[model samples]
Target: MVLEVVGVSPEEESVYRLLVTSGRATAEDLAQRAGLPAADAARILDSLALKGLASHTDGTPRLFRAAPPDVALLPRLKRSADTLELARLEATRLIQAYQDTMRRHDAGQLLEVITGAEALRQHLRQIQTCAQDEMLWFCKAQYVAMPSGSNAEEFEALARGVRYRVLYEKAFFDDEGAVDNVVAGVRAGEVARAVPHLPLRLAIADRSVAVFPLVAGGPHGSPEEPTTALVRDSNLLAALIALFERYWEDAVPLRVDGSDALSGTDGSGPAEALSPTDRKLLSLLVAGVADKAIASQMGLSRRTVQRRIQAMMERAGAETRMQLAWHAAGHAWL
Candidate 1:
């Protein structure tokens, strides 16, 4: 570490150390002992004397002795501490002045990479707190959202009438009790949907801030350490929002039961909540949409949609697709 208080050059320190150890010594002797030239040694001793770290007497030649550290270094250290305090006071203005300059230039920071799962969770809570309008998410294949503060954060946001649209991958529904959990969320005022595939896990709030994982988790694969990014309002964030809307437009109803009273969701869940795309999916299932084409249009994969359909078929306790449809129609779930 640098000793800013003394602030002496290496050569000066060498000269001082030599004198302090040697008691009293001539410049010529110190120069030899300290590996410095005679003139350099003399100059350093005089400099140390000026700092009050050393004292000198003239006899046959000048002899120098170090002052006790308490008498010398202590005062210099105190002055340094005082100077640092003054700098600390001025730092507030300096920082704000810089921020003002950046604002005037219309230049500022917008993106940040966040590391560590706990820290990311903290940021999630912060994001919820900061949100003012809507929240969007693309949670795929696994539990990407490590619940922050015991599920209180999302509930608080929902309680405030903030819009929530969450998309899930087919894999997200495979977990035990997943349907029950989703029904709970639907009851809590979140419009939810599922697609064949999701490219990444993401959370965007108020159209102002967005986060996407750098590490994969859930069905994708659990990482010991997870990381994500927080991108502020920018072209990248806009593109992400657009991507979600496209998927939302084609997404099928994530419904187990058709009763609006049971869930309180305004019939926006995929299935009977039909757009032209859902109708096409319904029609094409009879002929087939060439999995790739359907997946592309729906922002998921053919396999993902296939898996979801199969899961629904099994939930209906049916052995075939026709049976699944008949069973669903009986409950008006289609």
Candidate 2:
């Protein structure tokens, strides 16, 4: 191991050992005593002299001698130690430099792209799970909310005392089981609203971070290859939160009271028929919100909300949505 560390082969070490034991001798005699050929002895001694392991006299038929073991070996070992120290110091500097570069790269990367459907789900679940206070979300596309039964993440957040506010677009209710899923959510304690024309699909957890689709083509309901984004604190995130609030102000709450009055517009335009939830839905419609937007506010399926509107129109004996609204207002349906 010592020879290896010192970069000396076994044959070279043997020759070096022989010279060290014998103190001084001519090359040919040393080779004969050391079991080496004359030519081999000359070459080795010459090589050892160059390596500072041996020295020779200036006389003819030069007399070769081993260097003082203490002097020769100590300086070589010291050089090895110095080289090792320099390498260690260089490794430490490299590690520190790598850490700094990674920190800068991470700091500058506030937004990250996530591809594929299942990957998007994992990211959503992690974000929701980490939310400490609240989660704000908008679901305008089915591709984001499909296979609808995987809603345990939201309930888990609610269980953790995180307030959840979700906005579902009117079209979101068109899915077969969307109304039931939302009703289940309402029972689980999330405060949900429905709106007709939500801008895009998004989920923000703790107001510190957001996840959204970086979808190509259009922002709503495209079933193409899914690509999502993780957005950290930034002005862009602030605007996203602001956009939700703006729509929230006009959203309708989901009321599953099974009230007869809410389902029908009284011909007499009576004051007692509508529940607060019912009134909110109609009010948004009267204020020009589309069915999809109303569904978003209420978390009911778009189809469900449309059915309610159709029933209301039938009760008012109106042929169109606009007429039904005018009649309800004339009669004070709320």
Candidate 3:
């Protein structure tokens, strides 16, 4: 019993044995039997009393006796030990959280310059390949309009049941080829949409990583002059996803028929609602063509195309070309 309380110490067991055999003894008698000093025996007796394993009787000379063995003390001791360990673990977790916050504060802005079109393409492919559940994209028409190897990879991922939600500009409706591709994707039923003038080009995969263009303009500039950033941190990715959802809430739906209607206008519209020049400009925008390329294609000055796009923004009530495209596509106006 004493071994269970104080562990297997030679002195404690010897003292317990002396107390048991002698029935009750003075500290001096216990010390002689246990081969320990009188002061040592007194200290051990006090420790045993504190443990409730033994008691000292009050008399002319104090004498110790082993208490009735209590089976309940073993489980009580174990529970107390477990409670203390849990408190230690909780304190460690709180300290780790504080350390992580300090680390983020110590490291401010982080930037990396990755060169080459192929490098950029590979980076996008890597994100798609690693996506386990869902991929959300807010893209300009130019990204989907222009042919690239990444599209094939993205399509393959969709085929494997990786969920996808993409937003495109109204200009996509102007390009028969681009529209056809979108229709095909819609047929697959893996992608959902809101309409057109998407200014920000962003991609999020599985809530773990995000990619976006650094340059303010759409991708229609030169591929050689592309600027983008890929983010892998979870907190930053969540913030980016939140921003995308805010824009998505105000966007229009992609499908239009008797079933789909804007509150103010009837489903039917005049042909002049969108002119040929407007359609052409939208296509160029989706293709990520520069102002010079759009101007050359339409036989108009670059400034004219820019002005028309500004006018389109006003007509669409859009702040950015990306938002304009999203709204246009959703309304089926583009």
Candidate 4:
């Protein structure tokens, strides 16, 4: 019965397994062993031979050989697997299309509640994979459902030409490996930015649907299970979009070159001469990251970070850190 999925009937599978165990068999031998009539066994054997699962020799009563299961069944299994995957993808598209229609016609269908961490993660992945045009994200620290690097969906979506605009709070970089993840994302065509902070975690796909927490501080911060809301096209969705755009407008762009060095220039005044390290430091500073946090994120000591800031200030003829930041902005150094 296990082989039925690949088009083998239970009776045929039984005959095939018996044949495999016996190595080779005549129609009468298989019939006696399987408790089936000789005529029925002969018919099944012919069917199996036609399916490449068995072969017959040109002799007296004829002999049937069971093809090696590995050779005969593996290819069929692979083809079946491929077909199932295609069906799954088609089902996902059909479900999305149906949901889109319902959301458009029925106002009550606009909001769906996703409860628990695993469910939240699955919805996030589904939306990202289904997204056609763009994805907007507000990534905050102390992640509620999934870790930052666990988002393989983002890369897959990016590969298919889905534009990603992600805004990370400054504290997000304080997490271990967070900087490396951001760098990897940037290299893979993600457009990343850093903000001093964000109010909540959010994701919007194609500007038609949004997902965010129904109440903040769930399993991560409390004993309660996490709860999230999937909102499709409404004034609430528009407000969420506006919230992301507001922070995005002021957030510092995160850029890294092929060499893994942060790189940027405004092409105006002294900003054009700024080094990669300087550009990175200025971006973090402008986002209100603390000196120690900056040092940690950039893999530098606190003293070393201060020294670099001092050098940058002197280069820009700045008497203080504020003046250096002011100059960096004026010349579009970040």
Highest TM-score among the candidates is held by which one?
A: 4
Alpha-carbon RMSD to native, per candidate: 18.1, 18.2, 14.8, 13.5
Write one digit per residue (lDDT tens) for candidate 3, span 1-334: 5454325356665676677678888889888877789899999888777766678878857978886645425655677678878999999999977766764765332223445455666777888888888888775655522342227767778888888887665654554466556555655654545544665778888976677766553354554456667765546667889987755543444543343331212112222355566777887886678889899989989887888788667767789988877767777655
The TM-scores of all predictions, comma-separated, are 0.48, 0.48, 0.44, 0.50
Lowest-sum lDDT 10-residue window in model 3: 262-271
Ranked by lDDT, the better of candidates 2 and 4 is 4
CA lDDT, every model vs. true structure: 0.71, 0.75, 0.66, 0.85
lDDT of 2 by residue, 103-190 (tens): 4678655688888777877888899888899999887746553356576888898998999998777777776677777777777887
> Against the correct fold, how does model 2 do in TM-score?
0.48
Q: Estimate the TM-score for candidate 4.
A: 0.50
For residues 258-290, write the lDDT of model 4, one tens digit per residue. 688653211112554555776898899878899
Q: What is the full ranking by lDDT, best candidate first?
A: 4, 2, 1, 3
- Best model per lDDT: 4
Model 4 scores what on Cα lDDT?
A: 0.85
lDDT for 51 in candidate 4 is 92
